[model samples]
Target: MIRIPTLRHVATRSLRCAARGAVQQRRWAQVHDVRFLTTQPSQAILEKYREKLSKKASQEGHGSIDDLKAAYSEKIQEQRKKDSTEGTPVSQPNAPSSFPPSKPAPKKASSSGEKPAIKPLGDILDLEKVAELPEKELTAIWRLRHASSPQTLCAVIPAPAYQAMESLARSNPYFVLPVPHESQGAEMHFMQWTFDPASKTSTVLFTQLAEYKARGEFAQPHTTVTHHLDLIKDKGLVLMQGQVMEGRNVQPDHAKWLVMCLQRFYGGWEQKGDELDGQRKERAEERQKLLEWFTNGDPRFSVEKLLEEAERMG
Candidate 1:
């Protein structure tokens, strides 16, 4: 029994020594592997790996989660302070509740037919109020409102009247001018039609006849003959009454009416002259026919006649 106990004690001591030796050998092998597996890793490699792990932790909302929560709390507190300073109500998020709630997806619009909206110029300009303004004010208003066509006479009148005048002015370019002295007391205001080189059209500007009389200039009635003669000499044609002025046999009534229309159409800026050519000569002939129509009320010499003449000229 004494031999047996001694042998067991020796065996236990040997086993413990072997186990310790094996553990030390394994640890030595692990250290060796780390030092020179293939090539020794540099200090930079270890540092890079550590940095990558830190970045991954941060992106996964683990490393900086506390920091982010603190930042958000600070932001909310700052917003509350701003709202308090501005005297505005600050909306707060509600705390999570146990009650169940239903959510619905947004609905799309129907693809069925739908008309677009329309807006008119009259609706754009309050015509009654505009008409009440003086000419200078009216011009300024037009300049402010429609800068593209600022000098146009349509700026001063009512919507319907302006439309009519615009329609008339489109076909003829007349200039706005004070009526000759001869028609100073006449009910109709007159403007001298002149050619505009820039626009290649005649234009006119008109206001109330009383407005001109109020200016207290040209107290005597002035003949339109000198005006027409000057226009013919300079521009070769006077655009008037929706007709080009050219040739002989221009009647006084027609001339007077043309001047009146011009005044009604323009605000008083004179235009340049038309380029004289064969086409102008034909236009002149047609103008003579319009004059004949104006004087005699002859249907034969009307616009249709002028159109026919234009066609023949073509």
Candidate 2:
């Protein structure tokens, strides 16, 4: 025979169930609030794996883990030194606390993403006694901050002017020398360059492949050419003489294209051949466009104007 349960017993059982549900809900909310949960490999999990890997490495007699830790330590020390020198606040990377006590990241100085302030040409020219500055600094000061096209295509600029162009070009993502363009498809390859301010000369080393191969990304330059230029002050022309130091791997077709570019852009020579072919005509048209862009177009290299505006604003 079944007996009826007491009302007190039923009420007590319901209360206990509610309490367990509340506890579970609170635990789930805490997990949801953790920021690392949304990103790949939660920080806690990463640390756990890292510790396991370190232990394994130690046992295997490979110091990979120790080396990585040492490198990170050195980086932290360098950062601290820099901060101290610059009078900025420093934070230790290996602090006991893994994460910062909930704080928002600092806002950037400019929200609009505007370009940096420009100084006037006059102010730069009239600077007090001048001493030799590093090549990088000189490049920065003399940089062509505004140019119409990626390819400057200027005819014989002075050493200083060309260097300024190179400064800007180096910063560009697509800065490949011997850049072929015409009726045929483009063949793009990387280029590395070095400059000597005293001698007013530059050397360009062109790579063979557009992208990395099995051998490596950078093999010795397929073609190495040193450019010696004479500055014609009155005409504002740069007369370039190229000496091909190395071209063992350069194909015949590629060499022809390279010479054409060197003559048209650097040497300030018009494209000429026994036969006036389509390629020659195309190059001539390109040259004309560049000339028009430089002469009629703004060309936008007035440092004085920019600096004056900056000072006026101040």
Candidate 3:
């Protein structure tokens, strides 16, 4: 009843339990090793892994294993385009032999073969052949008495008197003995005066368009003024005094030059104009005296007596 087992029996039972545990562990180890080599993955498990990879690729954008093949193909096409654009020759191991090489086009010539030549003035004018020039030029040469038309004729004389003036004009200063042209005749003279010294006087002639065109010989002067220049007393004033003949003097340049010369000699002619004014006043006083004599002596025109008589009658 309640008796303990012996030592030998206990050792033998413990060894048996230990050996069964070792056998169970070896069986579990064999199952784990074989599963690694022979067991196939399930479809559901594969689907879960594929979903995880797709999620990872979507999170990282296009830089994924699935898109790598397309990216590589695009890179190859871009390289080919770059090479062609840069004019770099591309070497292919097996290239097509059907296409031919291109060549550059030749340059074209200008449409117009040559430019026109310019003519010299000598060729246009033909100076060697004077007769070949136009009729107008010939007429101008004949009328002007020179190659170009002249404007003024100047002659310095000894004094301002008319006798001295006439002598100088006849001898020189002008182109004398001009040959008359048929249909055109000769040009008329437009004359003026300029003085070199205040004492010395000169008769000047100018060419006007009308006078130059007129078909006649030179006529009498349009105007003749005997200007007295008193260099000593008046300094430089030209006295248009003594006898001033305002003939037909149409040329203003003649008069202007005369005035300018007078101003150069004398400061101004305002005092001369004043002297003329005194002469005019004296003449007016003489006229008043003549009118008074007629009114008083001849009773018919007495205005005061007529008015008094009329008032008395009224």
What are the TM-scores, per candidate, against the unseen true structure? Answer: 0.18, 0.28, 0.16
**Following a full C-alpha superposition, what root-mean-square deviation does model 1 have from the true structure?**
45.2
Which candidate wins on lDDT? 2
Local accuracy by lDDT, each model:
0.31, 0.34, 0.29
C-alpha positional error of residue 160 in candidate 3 after TM-score superposition, expressed in Å: 18
Q: After superposition, how far is residue 179 of candidate 2 from its true place, in Å?
A: 7.6
In terms of lDDT, the poorest run of 10 residues in model 2 is 28-37
lDDT of 3 by residue, 44-82 (tens): 433556667566667767566356334445444333222
What's the ranking of the predictions by lDDT, best on top?
2, 1, 3
TM-score of 2: 0.28
The model with the greatest TM-score is 2
The number of clashing residue pairs in each candidate reads 20, 5, 4
Per-prediction RMSD in angstroms?
Answer: 45.2, 29.7, 62.1
Which rank order by TM-score, best down to worst? Answer: 2, 1, 3
